[model samples]
Target chain A: MTAAGNHQASRSGRRLERAGIRDVAAAAGVSITTVSDALNGKGRLPDATRRHVREVANRLGYRPSAAARTLRTGRSGLIGLTVTTYGEEPFTFTEFAYFAEMARAATSAALARGYALVILPASSRHDVWSNVALDGTVVIDPSDHDPVVADLVRQGIPVVSDGRPAGNLPVHAWVDNDHEQAVLGILDHLADSGARRIGLLTGTSTDTYTRLSTTAYLNWCERVGQEPVYEAYPAHDPCAGAVAADRLLARPDRPDAVYGLFDPNGTDLLAAARRYGLRVPEDLLLVCCSERAAYATTEPPISTLSLKPGRIGTAVVQLLIDAIEGVGAGRPVAQVMPTDLIVRASSQRRSTRTTVSPPRSPEND
Target chain B: MTAAGNHQASRSGRRLERAGIRDVAAAAGVSITTVSDALNGKGRLPDATRRHVREVANRLGYRPSAAARTLRTGRSGLIGLTVTTYGEEPFTFTEFAYFAEMARAATSAALARGYALVILPASSRHDVWSNVALDGTVVIDPSDHDPVVADLVRQGIPVVSDGRPAGNLPVHAWVDNDHEQAVLGILDHLADSGARRIGLLTGTSTDTYTRLSTTAYLNWCERVGQEPVYEAYPAHDPCAGAVAADRLLARPDRPDAVYGLFDPNGTDLLAAARRYGLRVPEDLLLVCCSERAAYATTEPPISTLSLKPGRIGTAVVQLLIDAIEGVGAGRPVAQVMPTDLIVRASSQRRSTRTTVSPPRSPEND
Candidate 1:
């Protein structure tokens, strides 16, 4: 053997000499097999003996090897939540809220099914498959050409995404809010409310939901035989929305209504309009595609397409648990929960009262 | 042996057979000694052989027994992050952002020093100490009688907290934001802005930071011989701020300025004030604690006390890493990063040419 091999063997011998099963057994005054049985909670040792053995083991700082136990049980009982690096900000408030909700839901689900949920932020440098200790992973922010999903698939790790990526991974499953239909519904509501010309304030172009919402807006404008005006801004910073709104509203033929792709953007647009002395739904109508907290308390509470974040969180957790429990990989499931158009003063053009839109049907989407 | 004892012995034997050194050796095409060396990454084996062994072992789902590994190595490369369940919603957003930032920093720090961070949600049902295989934990939202810290201490698990908990644990190291100074700074700015009567809008009374800020506001008001008109709302929900503002502003002797504990409350108050036709600063001045995303885009741009979240995140990670690396013990250490009050139109009196208050030493607090 090489000198390195000799050194390693000597180190192992020293480690064993420092603290071994024999040491634990000697300290407990029990046989090695008896100590093992007590440590594993396997045999029905006398209560006093079991207690004594445990106390001694604790005092001695003995810890069983996780690898050995996992191999023997065929289960790690560990669930991982993998979030990607979107920008300098590791995760947004919306993403954080979603993750917390999902983590709580998954934790409860894991407990019921006998497991633990570990929130793991997948690094840009490491492949998702490297997190092999996880029984399964709940992937968030799936891009069109996600390398993480590809690696996970290669290593046969079950993955469920918070949003649907454009990849054709057969064994993949995802849960998402229907942005296409939601945007269309918002546009329809604006048209029904007598908005002659409507402007769209969009989020970052790279996001799937933003792209999808933009497509739906263009399609709806075409169907209604109306010209669509829009301004795109990065979603990460709300300040970008204000800048976009300023540019869009400065035109000679400014829109009578503004539809924001998300809650923050919608709120920012409204704030911008207020700065410019334009009144909501009178001088300019406002609508947003998300139901985040800010939309509810704005001066003239901005109209929102309410996506049920908690419900989506719950569904994702259930799907992940199902997959981990050997439920046939979930059939490339794409479950889209519908969005509710909550009309508040910002988009309420009509003098008469109107009914709030019903909750979206999850099954239909 | 008794029949039950015999049965348990047979089951344990089968478990041992499934996860023995022989199994790993066979999977890796190496002798038991070579397999052990590769698993430990200490012996001189061909790099390809070591890589193949690790891959095959992972594929075969090898999990080294924690008991065995701990006894041999005297260490477990696990660090924990403990968060309370009370402020799950708002705290989730704040904590998740902080956690993600901390985790990223911690991951690099821990990996360099040889460790892993494991997130643990505070729970009464399951003992975090028993459930987690961690060398240490970073505690958050510490309560007077935090069970997680208590249990971990009883079990002798090293711990650090983001905030001070009620009980003084012997080995607990903690880091906290200087809320007292932050609140005083914002209030002082409001006072300098020609505001005679200042109102305070605080987060939920339950939060330690909210309580700290409220006390500071009351104390500062008492010292200045001014009546502090204040209202406390639940958590960080902007809707709560809107509701509270309705009552506070509707009063006959309404305060000239409102100082919010944080951005959401401040932004909400601004929105509500707009609904009441009270122009900011000219009519009712405003200032807030944290400069979150919403503050920059609000109408008349809300002035905010900017707490460096990224710096705080970096500090928390460094502290936790220090403890994990055995550089410190269970002692309370509070590190307060400086705060900057960014003056804007919301808090600026139109008559005054000086928008910014003169910079003051943060050490004054």
Candidate 2:
């Protein structure tokens, strides 16, 4: 066996002559054994010598083959972010904005703690759970009994979610806004304003956030003993909300107040109100759940339940980093941050509007 | 030296006991010589034996160790993206959106050709060009006489830039929108509208896009024989644009039309117009360059010059993939696509008379 190993080393050495241990040793002014010892962390070499050898190897543009490294470490810094098909929903600008914000936040946080975030588009061609060389994964919008989540857990990769779904495998950690309480708060605010009939506009039922918001709205209506009038759009774009608003408002029994589950949905509802000649508040009230920058500048500034997505993003990063460091593990953990309701012109009734004060000229304001 | 090397190897083996030639031989059910011969493509071996040996080693997760593998491969599939900082500019959102789109496109293209994109944020802590493990990098918004670009070239790592600075370099490939022509087109449209004095709302001077737009605005102003009244904002946010518009419009000789370099700038300008009691188009015409979704939903929809950012992203990916596949070398390539102007209400001034259509009764369009 020893003689056979010597023959194997000779053949391997010849094949790797251009980029072999000898070249690295020569570059670092160290023996081949020293270089080998430094890389594998063995053989009682001085710390400085090991550091010097490693630095020189890196400087010389050396990379251990991934296949070989995987065999040893059983891990890779890469973390896959599995997003549902852009084709399923056409990747709207709003989704793009949220993802961008989340990606930047996640990347910075990951790097600070020594990890890399690699986005992997969820495609049927590759197994979401098995193909990529990743240490862990963060999944967004898991469905009821999502196969992706199941397969990933079965493969033993740590999984964190943006929101929880009806899944058997215990979720490692999750960060989400308290949508139910947020909806109840909005409803209570509207009820206080003497809105007898309130209408609800929401995104597709597929998203967990939308479903949660809908459930909360229905519960609030039941508690208040009021008939629930609502519309769920097939998509999340502003156009969908606008069209839904038109249909809802065209009815003889129009809603006195409208609540949108998201920013685009809220913005669209406002546009539709203008088209229908319904003066905000006095004629029809409007409120949305997201405090996106665009909402703050729209015509009659929208009243929104500030979800503070940036804050949520920061929290998600902190949690992921903690998990990566092996600080938190075992059993599921879910975090819910408080939401703030921002009251603006859209929900302020004209009669209750203390002063018309020439719509605070955009320039002056 | 050979005896010393053997002694050190033996000592290292005793210290670590990590998988190496001996382990691969054991797993492969072959002599160590056969395993090495198969891996190196040196000594002749039967195809079936080589396949079986490789499969068994893979199953056993036997890594030759970094030192052993680094001695055989000189390249790493890591690519770097050098950005100054993630969130320093409001452009982060815009930049991130573009980058994500570009990344997705590049990933698909790179995989087809075999490469991976690794992002490395540019920081002041150290010269990133000197430290990252990368085959090549994509530099964004190069400053005039950037040393980083020079360092990358000296190191022989290929670079592709989104916007190359004025100073010359042996750039591998570049991709940029034709801002000069795009701005010129917007100016031509404004000139046709019979506007003599036009005000420009430009974004921060740090961006290459802003610099290009400013130069185009000045040149167009000179050619049309109109005063180039302009204000430069500190950032690209809508609030900055609004503040700039206020300063420009508040002057006794307020310009008739405001041309913003992008959508947020235009949105702010329109908002300022409302605040200043100046009706859009009638009192102050407005036009912007980006076709961001905000334009379609504004109270008075702002006209926009829509550039296909997604297409540009796709094009960049295609070019990078081609270069990686050895399609071209030592050849600097650049490509630009056309921009389309979508006219809307903000710039429409057929008549100034405020038509008081009956308050859109809840039933009207």
Candidate 3:
């Protein structure tokens, strides 16, 4: 008897009604071994035979049970991405340009490695977490001693984080931009652009990014013998940002140059500057941390601190997949990437025209 | 003997090493029935007991096996969201404001219903598809005869689409905007604004939205006895949009007004109009279909046709989850929703300024 017949005899009493591997072999006129090899790309076979077997299986609507496959391989090929939410809805986290860009790159990187990325809220219900079998997880901006991160670590699931974990949160690996260094560089750039005092538009969030950047700004101010001038607001609330920007400009001790720590701050600051009758690069210099392309086309295109979210996204996934596959089985891995300073017309005292300007058009501000 | 003793006696041989309900029962000094009731939110259980049981379970790092649960309950609590990609990466599809808003609403809606939404590329490989056990799926703008949709339907998976299915493709349910009516309304609005000649900026894709809108534009032109003048480009290609916008303006018989069918068309057409020294409203009226808030703050605040993507997203998920739960068992559901026309300065020849303007800023144009 052939191997196909033996296989059929063994499982016929249990699952004969469903379209099994035996059914595919019989339909394609191939042995069970040949069918298995063709489906899995295991053994060397003719291209035509493999295609034929796949087509036959597809026609029969033969699907390998995900649950059964999990039992056999012990891998679900799923990576959970925990997004830090600022509002009740988890999707509000992606409203920022930085988060959106980072997520896109991470999704692309994960897909290229044959794993599907699942977006799970950081504050997801226990049942939601228990329903999906994740090979590992990637946490973005984990809070200090996050319960979710702690639970996952205790469960032995490898976790890679986009932002450096605050406090003593245990993470398998982490990829983050050098936030302190990036902030200092931006402050220096504004100082060199002939600004008397430099100010900061920052967030009240306690996440590592906001905290680190604010600290760096304060340190820079102290080192330069200048008092820090800044306004802080709840970044997640859309209306609060504009009010804070207006308040900053309304201050009696307003700084000549300002840097915003969030994405929408560029526009908010620009509108504020207009209300004060201050032209960019003349009375006010503007810069913001963002990955939005719209800033490149703004009136007097705004200077921006590019966190290079794409690189961070790719690095986090690579480190995560490596930890999952046990490529580097040692201590935790930490990667800190450099930031890019995109100089534009808004940040310069004199129009050097260093960057390529758009097509000649009437400037409307 | 008590129920807890019987349960422990029956399962002690197989899973004594692992933390089980018996472990929780013994630790909390409760019956096994009480532990199960507290954990599942079933039966009359005090809130304190439920919280205590949950804390113990969390501390023990005990997770219900997703595979075993699937076998027992036959539901995974997972919903697949198939995003139609315009490029190689699935993330590019979310670059549009309409899509981003729609997805956000869908994610919010799914989470509210106790289901975690998974972002799956519409062109996902077979392995990716078969690796997750999804109770239902939400397909966004399914192509005519989409193999993925067909395969899912064959496997008895419920699929609810955001757009109407092309051809005779079988779908469990669908929700779509009134695209033809939306187009006709926008054309009439432009004509009413004293536009002698109006043109359209459309896409070359054969999807239902593009096809319906384009056909409606053509029919409107015929009704007005004006020769059709429009530019069609591959909407997925980012750079192609700007080139097409410029091409439309450079024509000898240039249009006095134009309506774009995509999101970025507002910015692209504005730049093109500037290059020709054509002022908005005075020379060339502009409008585009978008859900972007940035358009509200543009120099001449461009008019926009809002497809109300949030409503559509919520409706699609509601229909899908309803079908998944076997609620309202009947024929397939089809919902057509209305669109909103936001008339801004760019669409009006003589600015009546009916809408409340932003805090007056210096206009350089």
Candidate 4:
């Protein structure tokens, strides 16, 4: 309680705090800038010098002040990854494997580059969004009139989106799969499998992926002189997918082959086939867009149009980081990643070729 | 440039800046405290007056400064959600359906409390963790000697763990399932279904879930006067689960019934059974702990012991928020949530009873 005690208490408070960068520099007998460069792996520093500085810092247990660094660099070393939801469910994170896989890859990519990701909702209030300083953002499937994307653009935050932005929403960069080409490839694959009448399972959503795939399918159906036999549903609802698949199969003029747009449509359609006494590949050839490994284990593995979410996620983060670190910040980078069409029994015609299953065979000894 | 042009440029620059809390106060014709209260849904205020102030603030596009608010309240309104990794790979976010569901519930619960969750890694370096100011942390399966959790606790930040801490890790609160009770109940279920010898496919990890479940399994086997039959492997690797499942079935003393302790164990066990020319219910009754709904549609529909991740997530967040808000902050809060056993064709005796599916069936005319 005395003046001397107060002085001692203040001194103890200082001791309780972790060592700072200045202490590291003093301990290393180097300039503060040299310590910063050595720790951050930046500037031209000899390997020996960097090692020596790091050892000194380690010995002192000195941690550089992130807040001080942010103040100096005007960067928070934080990336915002936005997930848009159709309803009030908290973690549609697993509504589909695509979003979960894409996010996992993006988080991995961001962490590798000394940055951390903050998961924010697309419908986040402006106050919540603006609270933390973000160096950039990755918007997953931003719609044409996304007010969040627009707001980020206005605030001078660089954005890289997973899907192609609709209506020319000026994001700094964007990465998406060639959906049209993928759909057309599926159509050709089906046609080659001796499909006279091929149907489509798509979504009622106006997102670019659905739009492009549907347009491509309609165009293919017209060129092939086949009537468009397709069913559309709200893609966010898994139950809706099952219902739609059933309706498509129950139609009076059910097509012999079907291609679904969403991830769950494969299992839904397969189950629907079972209910109607239709055999997959023989009675109802099937293909769907998905990134799940579970497809490889389905009764007769269902073929898939893989968006290669990992590649897209990695690319989006790379572009966003480049923008943040001032690399190609203004180059208007737009990347188009490729899709993979994994062949399985569900989509192959009855006698095209002998199918080899995944490396596991259940043949008893 | 003319003086008039210079003045105009400076004025425009000021205009381009976002409206601050002060602007809201001025626009709403209220004091700054009243404006803060109105926006944050705090304090005693008439509903009509609050609505009027909120409308005025919205019209002015006013945004509060997160940094300033943190400094004033000594709380950042941010929660840190740490995901422990098994290997060098970045995303264990989707490693299990449990994590995805838990995180979803946590995110929703945090958002409901006007707080946001920040996903950070358990192995994050000091520089990265120290940079962000956090109100509290939710650690998912932290080891006893985790430096991150220790650092947070030493710094006087509250930490609520999802899994029970291995040792006295000094967490402010924790929420976990009664793993022992759940495992024993699972054993009883299989026994009631006429399981003479119940083998286990478990992980070699020292995590509390594995430790408790395996211990309970051994104890139950002893109680029933049966020899322990089990196989252990690293649970993080998806391929490892399949191999372990095969190894268990390949054992000379292969039991007629089995329980798996991981998410993908059901399918892996089923595949292993097929490889050995074994029928599911007739030859090898099966059960696994998982949160995946896909199990419902698998061949013979696998039974699952759901840990109720949503309840755990929500409870963890509520405890963390209560700690952050200084409500029962000093209270020793530890909660145990119940588990759900979803009976399916895989676990029931062949002629036990008619099984009920989930509450959805496509209404067909």
Provide the TM-score of chain B versus the true chain B for each model in turn: 0.72, 0.73, 0.84, 0.86
Runs in model 3 lying further than 4 Å from the true structure:
A1-18, A21-61, A352-365, B1-61, B225-227, B328-330, B349-365
Better of 3 and 4 by TM-score: 3
Candidates in order: C-alpha RMSD to true structure: 9.5, 7.9, 5.2, 5.7
* A15 Cα displacement, candidate 2 (Å): 14
Best-performing candidate as measured by lDDT: 3
- Across A1-365, the per-residue lDDT of candidate 2 in tens digits comes to 45435545656646442244556677787787898899879999999999999998878655444444444565455565655555532234566656656666666655655565655555433322233455677766666676766656655567777666555545578888898988888887777666899988876666668888899989988988988888878764546767887877776778899998766777677667767787776678888876355666666677777666555656676776566657776656789887677777777665453321223322110
DockQ of 3: 0.46
lDDT-superior candidate, 3 or 4: 3
Query: What's the ranking of the predictions by TM-score, best on top?
Result: 3, 4, 2, 1
In candidate 1, what are the lDDT values of residues B144-164, reduced to their tens digit? Answer: 777667766755566777765
What global local distance difference test value does model 1 have?
Answer: 0.66
Docking quality tier of candidate 3?
A: acceptable
iRMSD (Å), candidate 2: 6.3
Model 2 chain B TM at 0.73
Candidate 1 lands at a TM-score of: 0.75
Native A-B contacts reproduced, model 4:
0.32
Q: Specify the poorest-scoring 10-residue window by lDDT in model 3 chain B.
A: B356-365
What is candidate 1's CA lDDT for residue A4? Answer: 34
Residue runs of model 2 more than 4 Å from their true location after superposition: A1-28, A31-72, A88-90, A127-132, A145-148, A203-206, A236-239, A350-365, B1-119, B124-135, B144-155, B203-207, B236-240, B350-365
Using Cα atoms with residue i matched to residue i, what is each candidate's TM-score against the true structure? 0.75, 0.78, 0.86, 0.85
